[model samples]
Target: MRFASIGSGSRGNGTLVQDGDTCVLVDLGFTIRETEKRLARLELAASAITAILVTHEHIDHLNGVGPFARKYSLPVYMTPGTYNREKIGLMPALELINCHQSFAINGFTVVPVPVPHDAKEPCQYLISSGSSTFGILTDLGHITPHVAEQYSRCDGLLLECNHDPDMLAEGPYPYPLKVRVGGDHGHLSNSQAAGLLSQIELSRLQHLIIAHISEENNSIEIVRKEILATLGEWQGYLTIADQGTGFGWITLN
Candidate 1:
């Protein structure tokens, strides 16, 4: 299995997970043209996407899902709550997923684990092809036991390091916005993300890609230092998913 991030930030977010000929996109947040361009950067065409799995109704994750799915004739999967709340118009093939169940598309097995984001029926994904598992956990406030258990054994992990607690406390966002971000239903801080690593089985982890970093409220150095502190001397391929050039494809054997 192999995976690449299309982008990751407050502006937009998308990820490409591939196994052989099957490629799936998770949350297309850019416009149709922009998504096409980003895909082109990865040497992929929109038609190459076998399916789109939506996490929530936030614009940063749902903006281009409707148009892109319609244009490419791709199948889309999401919880009923997310579909009803977003009102994503019409789709060529729409599949309503239960957040508590596991489903298969092409060669990938997808496990939708519900998360505590402030959206209607939010969930992150754990995808696997045979024995290799790739898990993506982002846009959630606190990590629940179920989430920790589900993501503990991934071969590759795209974990969200959304902010630094001290930075977010004194950052530019207004008080209420700050409270929301730091609340139980908002994004995770560097410490919170690191805390999750304690629950994860590092021996099985081959790739650790830090994602959804806030450009304004956090810096690369801070996030890197925080995560490194938690990881200690564990040697694995560590990377950061950028907003502009989201990192190249990473293959897990």
Candidate 2:
């Protein structure tokens, strides 16, 4: 299995996961044209996507999902709550997923784990193909015990390190917005993301992609320092997903 990010930041987000002939997109935050252009950077076309799985109704995650899926005539899966909350129009193929259930799409097995985000029925995805498992967790304020357990044994993880607490506290997001971003239903701080490493099994983990970074409130250097400090001697391929270029594909054998 291999995965790549189309983009990752407060502006937009999208990830592509594939195994052999099966390819899926998780969250498409850009417009249809922009998404196609970004996919071109990864040497992929819209028709190559087998399906689209959405994490929530947030614009940065759901904006392009409907248009892209509709254009490609691809199936889209999301929780009912997410579907209802978003004005995504009509889709050619729509599948309502239960957050607590694991479902199969094409050749991939997808497990949706509920997360405590501001969105109604927000959840992250754990995708598995053959012996490889790739987990994506983002937009949550804190990691729940259930989340910790679910993501404990992933082969590759795209974890969110949204902001630096100090920077967020002092940055220019206004007081209420800052409180919301740092609140229990907002985003995860760098320290909070680093703290999760202690609860997961990273022995067999291969790739760790830092995602959903706040351009205004966080820096690559700060996130790297905190995560590296938390990881200590652990040896894993670490990559940061950028807002413009995102990151290249990393294969897991």
Model 1 Cα RMSD, Å?
A: 0.7
For each candidate in turn, the TM-score is: 0.99, 0.99
lDDT against true structure, model 1? 0.94
Badly placed stretches (over 4 Å) of model 1 are none
lDDT of 1 by residue, 1-253 (tens): 9999889988999999999889999998999999988989999877778999999999999999999999999999999999999779999999999999999997899999999999989999999999999999999999999999999999999999999988998899999989989899999999999999987899999999999999878999999998999998787989999988788999998
Give the Cα lDDT of each candidate. 0.94, 0.93
Model 1 worst lDDT run, 10 consecutive residues: 40-49
Taking the tens digit of each residue's C-alpha lDDT, what string does model 2 give over 1-253?
A: 9999999988899999998889999999999989989999999878888999999999999999888888899999999999999789999899999999999987899999999999999999999998999999999989899999999999999999999999998899999999999999999999999988878887888899999999999999999999999898888899999999889989997
**In candidate 2, how many Å is residue 91 off?**
0.7
lDDT of 2: 0.93
